[model samples]
Each structure stands twice: as structure tokens, then as C-alpha cells.
Target: MAKISTTLLAATALIALAGCAKKRPAVLPPAPAEQATEVAPSGSAGDVDPNGGPGSDADFRRSVQSNTVNFGVDVYDIDSTARAILDSQVEWLARYPQVRITVEGHCDERGTREYNLALGDRRANAAKNYLVARGVAASRISTISYGKERPLALGSDEEAYAQNRRAVTVIIGR
Candidate 1:
């Protein structure tokens, strides 16, 4: 009876030890390699130009309306390059006869909220001015500044901050 009890205790310990062992993930067969990664449009991913040049006027219009332009880099103090990009953006706006746009200005998370708001306002105004200059009609182009309240990227690095500091062009109406 004593021998049988000892054997049972040893078997139980072995069972527990086996149960505690780390189980490995099931390995599946290797998948076939593809020649290239296919680009597909989703919520965050914008459409890519298959032709590889600046897309067509129609495509540009779609892109502008879809919030594709990032005019937020602080690298430009003169702001002419930003203006020129916006000029092109407004040109794209002309294609959609009834569509109106709202330029939402943003800033990097480096500054105070109030200061960032002011900076963002300036950025939006710059975009608005360019659109107005290009004959987009002042009424059609409204401006708003989110400041640093809404950052596109959360990281503290320059690359992330650069992307966060942008004025996005949004299509408000048909």
C-alpha cells in the first residue's frame, strides 16, 4: 500500500511538470515569396500613382479632398514652398465645382498650447491665402487650427513631429 502511494505521488508530480512545460507554437509550412508588395488603399494609406509621376488632375482633386497634403513642416520659414504646394492644391480644388475645403492647421508638440494654436492658425491662414490667390473663392476655403491638440504622430522624434506639424486640407462639402 505504501509503495503504491509513493508511485502515485511521483506520477502526479511528473504530470504537473509536463503540464507546466512551455508549449511551442505550431509551425506551418513556408509561404511562397512574392515579387513585390502590393499597395492597397485603406483608412490611413493613400492611393499610389501607378504611372509614378504627379497624378492626373482628377486624381489630385480626389487626393486633396481625401486629406492627403501635409503642409506642416516648420522647415520653411519663408513659407513660399508651402504656398506653392497649396497653390497646386487649390488648383486641384477647382476640378470639383461644388466641393468646399477646410484647412485644419496643426503644430508639433514642442510648444505651449496657446503658442501652438497661434502657429497653427498662421499655417492655416497661409494655406487659405494661397487658395484665395488661386481663385478658389474665400467662401469655399475655411480655416481652423487644431494646434497641437491633435497630432498625427505621437513620437517625440523629428520624423514623427514633422508629420504631426502639418495643415491638412479636408473636403467639407460636395
Candidate 2:
């Protein structure tokens, strides 16, 4: 029984390693099952367009093209596509000055928790700083690092890892 269990563990580890070795696209879409967008409490305010625009985060999410951005395996830098998305977010934020948001930094199940946490911070700040530089209020934005805690894809494959490594802008108090 001991030998059997050892063999099984070895096989599982080998399969996981093989999956990560496979080549994959640079940028893959977020997991189909994972809905990445989130909204904050609107308080007693009804779901009306207080900003004369999209009333709720849901409406705002639908109005824009994409809500989340992807990152490289261990990278947190924002690419061109990410920049465009942030531009849109800045526009939305500017429209809704009353809104506040939190940029969540995430990572794939690779690297140590400490390392990933630091990397995740860089990722979140990368996005937040871009927005602030573009004129979004720094006070309204905040950051958090969830380092591999919240994975969109539940596998050891590169594709799964790619999906997992991302930065999500969640509406905290809109």
C-alpha cells in the first residue's frame, strides 16, 4: 500500500509538471466559469444613474469592453491592451467621481506566498498608478494582494496559470 501511494504521488507530480512545460499563448481570456467583475454596496441610494450614467457597476461593466486584465506568468506590468482598458476605466471613474474602487492583485499557484504577495502588490499598483497618472483620484483607489488565493482556473496547466494571473478592478463604493 505504501509503494502504491508513493507511485501515485509521483505520477501526479509528473503530470502537473508536464502540463506547465507546454507552450501557450501570451494572453488568454479569463476562465469562462469565473465572472471577474464585482460591485460595491450602493448604500440607501437606489439603482438610479446618480452620475447621469451607468447607475450600478453592473451597468458600467456592460457599458465598457472588459473589466479585468491579464498578466504574464510572473509579471505584473501592464501591457498595451491593459493600458487601453485602464484608459476606459479612468473614463468611467472620471464620470463617477463618487465611486471608489479597489485593485486586486492576483497570481498563479507558483512561487512562494511571500514572493507572490509582493508581485501581486506590484500588479495592483501598476494599474492604480496608471489611472492616477491619467488623472484618476488616487484617494478613491486602493490596492490588495490575494496572491494565488483566488484562482479563476483550477488546474496546474500553463493555460490555467495564465488565467489565474490577473488584476481585477472591483467597485468598492460606487
Candidate 3:
């Protein structure tokens, strides 16, 4: 009985090995599903404008034109500068009442993070305040302070730092 059992076990092992050894057919998987496009060739990420094309609100590129204000002495301020930008931003926004924008306030890395954050906040607030004054609905604009976390010019030089410290206006959801 023991010899018969041993022989059966050996046969079973051999059968399992044979089954595993058979070569399965190599299959070329089907190509991934392609996205449809408008105006361009099919299967492309083409120009299906989010705002339905030019002269639309979503299609408008929010401009961040810069202006410098003298705050007396060499100790100039960016808060007022931001306010000017926001004033213009509001005017443009009024034309497209449905548009939303975020005011990103940044500063040079000369100061501590906490101080910079506060300063950046003030800067954005200044802009927000100006926008409010200029007849822009407060809800249409949002503010954020980068606080030197993201430097426009990555260098220790004053020139670079000056450029780094700025308020940028960005367009939000359509």
C-alpha cells in the first residue's frame, strides 16, 4: 500500500509540472481607450475651449500688469503696489462678472517665514481691499500668501529678491 501511494504521489507531481510547463499564447493587449477631441484629429487632446473659444470669460487671460508706488525713503512697500494691480484686475473682472481669480502674494526671502507670511497676507489684503473699493464683488477674488516659499527669482542677490517679492494675479475655475 505504501509503495502504491508513493507511485501515485510521484505521478501527480509529474502531471502538475507538465501542466505548468505548457507555453501559454503571448497576447498583445488592446490599445488604451483614446480621448475624443474637437476641431483636431480624432483621439487627440485638442482645443475644445473651456470658455467656448475667444472673447469668452473662461477664455480670457487675466493680466498681472505691474506698477511701483513710492512709500517714502528706501523702505518701499508692496501692499500699495498690489492694490494697484487689484484695482485694474477688478476693472477687467467687472467686464466678465462670472470670472473668479486668486491673488498670490509673495515676498523676498529676507525675513522670517512668519513675518513674511503676515506681510504677504497684508499685501493680498491690500489688493482685495482695492478691488472692493473698485466695485469688484469681494467673493470673486481669493487671496493667498506664498511667503517666500516659491521664489520667482532663486538667488541671494537684491535684484533677484526684488523680483521675487511680488503679487501675482491668477485666473481660477471657469
Candidate 4:
């Protein structure tokens, strides 16, 4: 009877241990290779270099008032401020017709990954459409949505969220 009780207690302990096993967090799939491109280093919007070489990333960043445009929470609409920034980008693109650019859409860490990805796509297309309408050739532009994966700022606060929710125009090639 003593041996049987010990075996039962051991079995119960094993069951409890099994129930307490840790679970691995869900992993997201990798982004596509074809969609990847080298992004130019970020800098201040006012750091314009009038004598920067033509068709260069520095030229693009300098000639344009800003390479990024921020959006409101859960909103992808282009506001007046975003329009002004895109206008600068359009003007720069006109100066270098051979250049190709990618507009990367990003989001803050608020919603599900799927929801953020869709929203990011819309934000990117909105910027691309605006640029195309303003005379930047459609063929010269491409867009990718990084969703909430690539954030400009990391925090749960409003300030960080504001910075994270943006579309960045990257000069891919000339």
C-alpha cells in the first residue's frame, strides 16, 4: 500500500508539471525578399543641402522638405501637412526622373498584426497616389507595408504612437 501511494503521488506531480509547461510565443512569418530594399539613413527635415549631388539619396532628402509624413490614430487620410510634404517629394522626383522610390507604410503597436498591415498598405497607397497625381510617374514608385513591425518610436504613449504612425519615402535607386 505504501509503494502504491508513492507511485500515485509521483504521477500526480508529473501531471502538474506537464500542465505548467511554458508555451512559446507566436512567431510571424518573414517578409518577402523581393520587397526588401536598402533604406537611406534618417536625418532632420531641415537638413537640406542645396549643393547635394543630383539623383543621390542625400539630394532626395535635402531637396525634399521631409521624407516622412505622419498620420492620425487609426487614420490613413492625407492631411494638409502630409500633402505639403508630398508636394516637396513630387518636386524632387521631377528633378530626377531616373530615380525610383519606395514608400514604406508603418503603424503603431495598437491593433492586431493583420489589421495594422492592412492599414499600413492603405497609408502607403495614399501617398503613392498623391505623388502620382502630382506628376511623379507611377512606374517610378513602389510601396511596402511593414505594419507595426518597424516602428520609428517605441513606447505605449501617445507621442511614440504618433511618431510610429507614418509613411516614409525611401529612395531605392537612380
Candidate 5:
């Protein structure tokens, strides 16, 4: 009789615990629409592609000096070096008015996930704001933060950390 009672109690506890488990939702939100417009072939005579064709990612990279800007440790301020790089980006963006870009912020793998994410966001915004201030349209840019989840350099040394702490501008559409 005691064995039967103990078995019954164990089964009841197991069922109760199973009932507490939560089910994840199946539906997901739709992706946002692309912000850039297609470039017309005869839009402007001066808008000729430097490489081969306008509105291509390769053209944008080829036109700009650099697509990335590095930040100091735990800092999001745009220094003179970063400013120069973004200025070049702004000039390239001016030539390709229909182009759209995404600025991705990243950080070294030292801080907590939450902290790094926040820092990364600030870094991305800093770069975006600089571009907008220098005549790039605000609507043509979007920002995302990867924090320390995506590292340019995998090593744990200071050099690797410096490389990892950066914001990269990616040509998304045109």
C-alpha cells in the first residue's frame, strides 16, 4: 500500500511540472521593406559607374577609401581619423543619392552582452549621425548593433580587441 501511494505522488508531481512548461509562438513579424530605389540608366550623365555599373556594392567600395571606422576602447566618439573616413563615405554617398546603407556596430568580447549591445548601438548611431551631418540623407541609412557577437578578430589580445571595436558601413541597396 505504501509503495502504491509513493508511486502515485511521484506521478502527480511529474505531471504538475510538465504542465508548467511554456510553448513558444509560431508566428513571426514580416521583414521591413528596402529603402533604396533602383537607379535609372539615363538619370544623370555625371553619375557614371567608376568600375563598370552604378548602384553595385563593388562600385561603392571602389569609390570610397574605407568602409569601416574603428573606435577607442569602450568609446563611441568620432575622432579625427573616424571623421576623415566618414567624410569620404559622405562624398561617395552624395554621388550615389539613391544608395542605402546599413551601419553595423560591434564591440570587443569583454563586457556583458547587455552592456556591449548598448555600447554598440551608440557607436553605430555616432557613425550614422556623422554621415547625415555631412550631407548624407538620414532616410538612406539604418543602424544595427551586433555587440561582441560578431568579432573581426578572434584573438583575446589588445590588437584583436582594437580590431573588433568598430562600426562597418555596408551598402544595402540602390
Candidate 6:
């Protein structure tokens, strides 16, 4: 018992001496916050956000009223439902001037390639024009026709066709 007590006293004295030694400043000061260092809407993975919006592609879609509007087969006209969606989009745009978008016109797999491309162009333009008319800056919006190349749903049935015939509003930048 006496040996154990002596050993413990030495260990405690050594620990005390070790604690008295000075330590170098191991931590650096935090980097200064800079707005310029913030992520831009270059479509990089980091820029997109949900709260301030104009975020990443998915977050931007969720931030907006509607990211897609469907159309009837072979039609480029904007229906009432389509109009409402565009209206919501316009409202969202008004709130976020930094945001820019690309309207992608897609078609079902039923039409000829050339025909589908034409239809997609018309559809994309229709949505773009609607936004322009509703106070969205024309310069902030661009249109592209994917035609039947990119299908949201893959099948020969009407359900898949309907799902494929849509104009997708993509967030291009902030």
C-alpha cells in the first residue's frame, strides 16, 4: 500500500509539471467573411439554396410555384392551367431578379423528329413569351427544344406520352 501511494504521488507531480509547460497558439483566427467568396449561380453544386432561392437546379424548382407545365399531344398552345403555372413563375421571377432560367420544350415520342422539334420550339417560346408579357425580363429567359429526346416517362402508353409533353423551367443562374 505504501509503494502504491508513493507511485501515485510521483505520477501526480509529473502531471502537474507537464500542465505548467506553455502551449503554442494552435488555433488560427477564422477567415474573414466575404460576399465575393460566396457561390455564384454558375450551376456549380454549391450555389443553389432553398431559402434565399435561386439555388441549385432542384432547390430552384422547389422554390418556384411550378417548374413544369404539361401540354396535350401535338399542341403548343398554352391552356388555362399552363397560364396559371406561368403566372406563378412570373411572380417568382419578380421576387428574384438575380435568377435566370431556360425553358425546355419537350414532346411525346409519337411525332417525327423534325415535327417534334418544331412543336417543342413553339412550346418553349409560348412559355417564354408568357413570362415576358407578365413582367419577367426577356433577357433573363431563354428557350430550348429537347423534342422527344428527353422523356420524363418511358413507355408507349398515353400516360407516359402525357408526362413527356411538358415545358420544363430550368434555373440556369442566379
TM-score of each: 0.57, 0.69, 0.57, 0.72, 0.72, 0.69
The candidate, 1 or 4, that scores higher on lDDT is 4
What is the C-alpha local distance difference test score of each model? 0.64, 0.78, 0.58, 0.83, 0.83, 0.79
User: What 10-residue stretch in candidate 4 is worst by lDDT?
Assistant: 44-53
The residue pairs in collision within model 4 are none
Q: Model 5 segments beyond 4 Å from truth?
A: 1-52
What lDDT does model 6 reach?
Answer: 0.79
Reference-based TM-score, model 6: 0.69
Model 5 quality (TM-score): 0.72
Residue-wise lDDT of candidate 3 within 48-136, one digit each (tens)?
23444532323444333443211211232545555565566666667666556566666887887777777776666666666777888
Model 2: per-residue Cα lDDT over 21-138, one tens digit each? 9666334334323534333355544333433336446655866657788999778888999999988888877777767778888899999777888888899999999989999989
> What is candidate 1's CA lDDT for residue 8?
100
Residue 33 error for model 6, in Å? 30
**Model 2, poorest ten-residue lDDT window?**
28-37
TM-score of 1: 0.57
Error of 4 at 73 (Å): 0.7
lDDT of 6 by residue, 36-125 (tens): 223465565445463444454556566667889999977888999999888888877776676678898999999777788889999999
Which residue pairs overlap in candidate 2's backbone?
none
Clashing pairs for model 3 are: none
Where is model 1 poorest over a 10-residue stretch in terms of lDDT? 28-37
The backbone clash count of each candidate, in order, is: 2, 0, 0, 0, 0, 3
